[model samples]
Target: MVVFDRADDTLRHLARYWGTFRQMGDPKRSPAIAALEAVLYEGRAARIHVIYDGPTTVGGRLIPGAREQFSTGILARASAGTWQRLAPKADPAPKSSPLPGRVHVVQDGDTHPAQAVLMTDAEVADWLTATAAGET
Candidate 1:
């Protein structure tokens, strides 16, 4: 299970590996493969999780109840009875003055909340994706 301090980072990593699962061609019989696509296209700003078992050709399968947590805007999957439990660590910084209609951009790998930036949603997403891909 991998946890990201920022949602965008999670999405970027997921998108990069999405193609690997698409070749499988079916989700119902392959929950793990299907889940990857589902999360990449439908996931939102919430905790995102993914699970992968060995290739179905190798006799692996996704487990049930793998998508139960953070369902409203999160994604999860499991295979071979194993699931990745990726979750963000809670930020520990003290809150600052409340800004009306402001969006907070949390830093990826930020162990403390104080390091996060106050930016637009798009900026946050871009930062996450770029960071996940090992870009500056």
Candidate 2:
């Protein structure tokens, strides 16, 4: 299973979804999303989960249909935060199995430096695909 972190931008980049135009700027599939979806289509990923910070409120007014956009495996901000906190920490350099159901954050200069995989989107995608296929 692959769990994306701070995936608001990724959700916004869904090519099929256009409701998030203003906030997201463009309704095109991001490179990362595209690569992942390709892998999914090719029957590579066993399970895919995208968790984002969602259901945002501005000036105490809830955004219409914000929660509805996230129909698949989307957790509310509070719930996701709690899950993240409760989730087990991943060692930066594991001696044995590299990915034993652990979170590998895809980002540059992550706040939690220890758990982050500091790599470009394409690099991360390639690594994930190779690992999933037991090619790495």
Candidate 3:
């Protein structure tokens, strides 16, 4: 959280934007990629919390195939698993813990409620606990 002109003030603009490029192009130096890169640049006081919860590919390219675009070491896979047993309407609990992989971003707050997302590796639980009670 970079403080912009916060010398005597604590108020600052919070930028929580998400990007998705589902077209074909040079992702390495693409405009959208550059914009994200700039936002996360060092000494910029801008903290971009990147969450790969959207399309798996950028510019219509697969993640494993887009080597050049993700050359900045910003990509990594996580370990996630799902429950094979069904939940009981009789209030039965499961035995194993859920995996983590899902990502939820509260961009608009209570103004727009985020859609339901099924992620693994405990990602779902984390997101659910993040913004409790309301959605914008």
Best by lDDT: 2
lDDT of 2 by residue, 53-119 (tens): 4323222222333323233321122233443432213223222225433342323212121232468
Off by over 4 Å in 1: 1-3, 28-136
State every prediction's TM-score relative to the real structure.
0.20, 0.26, 0.23
Best by TM-score: 2
Q: Which stretches of candidate 3 lie over 4 Å from their true place?
A: 1-28, 42-44, 52-131, 134-136
Model 1: per-residue Cα lDDT over 1-136, one tens digit each: 3333443444344444654565655433444345654563445434455333222112222223333333222212322132122223323332443544332222342322223246888998999899999999
Model 3: lDDT of residue 113: 17
lDDT of each: 0.39, 0.39, 0.30
Residue pairs with backbone atoms closer than 3 Å in model 2 (clashes): none
